[model samples]
Target: SQKIEQNSEALNIQEGKTATLTCNYTNYSPAYLQWYRQDPGRGPVFLLLIRENEKEKRKERLKVTFDTTLKQSLFHITASQPADSATYLCALVSGLYGGATNKLIFGTGTLLAVQP
Candidate 1:
């Protein structure tokens, strides 16, 4: 079993600027690191997915980095917009249920508020 730290702080940033959010974990090694965006009362929308073997991954204005040794992953959004405001969730694969299956452990999530 692993513990996922919750970052309850809200991140406020100006539109057109870059917003960087961090995810830290302890007690388990995840096979893959994933990021998601969730709006109030809605399910999370998948964002970035990085493998443990990969150091970094990028798509358009979104980028993510995984450092297994540091037990952390970073999520970045370039030229952020007010529409990007939402709660960001950090998730990783776990075997808490056992049997070589992938179950995800999600963090409490950090809220990002992009102001125009």
Candidate 2:
């Protein structure tokens, strides 16, 4: 079966720095990859998405890179701040079973805490 993997531990960072998050998967090749940010007691907000043919994508201080060959995705936040701290999750379309409907399979997510 296909599986998505992410760092189970929380990440701590100082203000005005960069925070990098990793997401890995196995037994599948996804066409699209998405990243989302979730704050405590709230729903996740969409961050970015990268297609399999795209190498890198960015928006403001956020950047995402997808490597289909390696079956991995990296999420980055530059000039991080306290407000930017949240749990980040990576999701991909489960093309294996739900090819027609394209169900999204999300990773467990990694928590990020930025100190002021």
- Model 1 RMSD in Å is 2.0
> lDDT value for candidate 2?
0.93
| Deviation in Å, model 2, residue 104 alpha carbon | 0.6
Q: Could you tell me every candidate's TM-score relative to the true structure?
A: 0.92, 0.94
RMSD of each: 2.0, 1.7
Flag clash pairs in model 2: none
Which parts of model 1 are misplaced by more than 4 Å? Answer: 96-100
In order, candidate lDDTs are 0.92, 0.93
Query: How many clashing residue pairs are found in candidate 1?
Result: 0
lDDT score for residue 76 of model 2:
94
Error of 1 at 59 (Å): 1.1
